[model samples]
Target: MRTWLRHHQYAFLVALRRLKVQPFSSLSNLLVIALTLAVPVLGASILLAAQPVVREIPTSPEMTVFMKQNSTLEQAQAFSQAVGKEFQAELANVRLVSKEQALKQLQSNPSWTDALGALPSNPLPHAIVLTLHETPDLVTRADSLAKTLQTRDGVDSVLLDSEWVQRLAAILSFIRIGLWILMAGVGVVVIATVFNTVRLQALNQREEIAVARLVGATEAFVRRPFLYMGALTGLLASALACGLALLALTPLNKALSSLAQSYGVQLTLSLPEFSLLLTAAILVAILGALAARWSVTRSTQY
Candidate 1:
């Protein structure tokens, strides 16, 4: 065990010494890794940042069912109750706003209050807000429910205000697809960057590797140091990426916080995602080192 430890310790020292001797080359490789990793890291941040905003979206574009001008209180109340009973299974939440409540809401608006002072009677009608379970069947179910509401005695129009919601959903879908494509493209670049670095390192140390092999060192023994060095490089690059992300976020936070404060909210980078990014970086390094090993082995004379 002591002998094995000494061997590994020697290899690790050698790797460090090589980096010290080739500082510029090592920095260039680290920069390549950092640039390549930045794409996925940024992509992940965007996706995470959208999560809270997406949750808030359902409230913004909900379906509003308005009663007719001539709608009697009894009839509107009965209709709302019936719809609630029928949709209890599929609905997420339902709210019935009576004409009196609607009037009070409008009166809270200065312009509406001034206009109401001129009118003898309230022009606002009772309304119902319906929130549905987010499912694949939502649109079809909502359409059918809207048709049912339209034919009701007191309903003015079953205004399914889902147009904006649908548009938002489409946009989010496009973003998700675009993010995946971006990740895949950048992942390929990261692999290539590491592979080239490792290949070059192998070439420079060919004489040392040949001597090691001539002394009966196994391929795994010869490859271990390069793999460890590659892993360390990737881990360092990921750390640099985290710092870059934080630096970029400073300006964005100032701008976003101004808007978010009004909504009782804040935007932030999900720090938990750094662990995932680090893991991805490590995997990329291992794969790249193995690829380099395979290529070098095929061409190596020893």
Candidate 2:
């Protein structure tokens, strides 16, 4: 086992030396892989960055129902209950904001506190804020739910904040579709890159390959060095891609911090993202190697 390991290490060093001899050739291959990987990574990062904003929109885009001045507490509670039942699956939760709470909120404002305090009666009406669930069809559901709530007794009006929800849903949909398309396109590019690189390697080593076959070297033995070369090239490309991602993320992280602070959210890419990225890199290398091996094997046979 020890001797076998030493021979493998020697072979790897031989491959490395061979790769180093043709510096521009390896660099070109690496650049191609980096370019291919960058597209999907950029698209995915954008999608991930937009997630916090998209999620917050659903929670914030709530329907505010104002009660008629004449409506009693019992009437308001009953109406809230009906809404809760009707949208049990659609809504996250609902609560009736009392008149006093409304007054307190208004009073808390410095501009209106002094003048509002002078009024003999609290002019604020009871309101219900209906929080909706996170669903793709949230906007349509909100509209339907609003129409149902508008007809309830003692309900003055149902205001569905349609604009925000609609915009958010549209943004999320676009991100998802665009990311998938970008990923698919990147996959094709990587395959083409590996194919071209392998084709060149096979062409250049045709005489050597013929000599190896005459010496009784198995096809796998002839193919092994090229496979290793392809994998190494891909690995180098992935490293460059990771470096580029970090470079791109520096400004992105700063912007995300500012956005988080503004939106009162802790928006940061978690550890899982790093793991997935590493896995993606390794997968790119393995897939590229397999593609190169398959191409060479098909073109050079016993």
Candidate 3:
């Protein structure tokens, strides 16, 4: 174990020295890798930040049954009671808002004073609002209930208030799928970037590799330093990427914070998330190095 550790330590030392040899070139490679990685990392962070807000939104389906202008509060209440009795299993909460109550609510709101005051009589109809029990069949159930309501006595119209919420959910789902695709593409780009970096380094040192093989150095032994090189490159690039993301977020959040604050949420990356991103970066970088295996091997003496 001690011998193996020493070998690995030597290989890592060599890798670090190789990275330091041309500071400008290495820094440029790191920056390129960092920028490529930043795209998906920032996208993922934004998606995760939006999750809490999405969860806070009330997506439960609702139905509002408006009564005729001539319908009395007693009729609306009786219908509400009937709905509660008949669809108790499908219903979560049911409330009847009488026309007088709605008018009083509008009256309470000072903004409606002039428009409402001009009316000789209250124009609002009694409304029975149904909040359905959440189910996979919620839309189907709401449609069934709506059809039934439209046929009932004194019901002016049944309005279903579920489509927009469902549409919003669908939109978010599409965006999530799109984000995953973006991540996959970014991963490929990461591997390619690292692969090219390792390949170029290997080509530059091909003569040395050939001489090492002549000295009886096995491929694994020769490859260790390069592997460490790729992994370290990836690790450093990812760290830079995270820093870049945070820097980009500072200005972005300054703009989004006021808008997001209006909705009660924060849009910052968490500690665990940084750890996760770093792990991803290192793994991808290592893959890139391993992919450049042929480049580091000398098939014929150079």
Q: What C-alpha RMSD separates each model from the true structure? A: 5.1, 6.1, 3.7
C-alpha displacement of 265 in model 2, angstroms? 4.5
Instruction: Rate residue 256 of model 2 by lDDT.
Output: 79
For model 1, how many clashes? 0
lDDT of 3 by residue, 174-256 (tens): 88898789767866766676677677788788888888888998878888888788778878988888888878877777888
Per-model TM-score versus the true fold: 0.69, 0.67, 0.79
Tens-place lDDT per residue, model 2, 34-66, is: 877776686677767667667665456588999
lDDT of 2 at 276: 83
- Residue 27 of model 1, lDDT score: 88
Off by over 4 Å in 2: 1-11, 49-62, 65-143, 149-158, 161-170, 256-272
How far in Å is the alpha carbon of 7 misplaced in model 3?
Answer: 2.7
Instruction: Give the C-alpha lDDT of model 2.
Output: 0.78
Can you tell me which runs of candidate 3 are displaced by over 4 Å?
56-62, 67-82, 118-123, 133-172, 264-275, 294-302
**Global lDDT of each model?**
0.74, 0.78, 0.80
Model 3 residue 192 lDDT score: 70
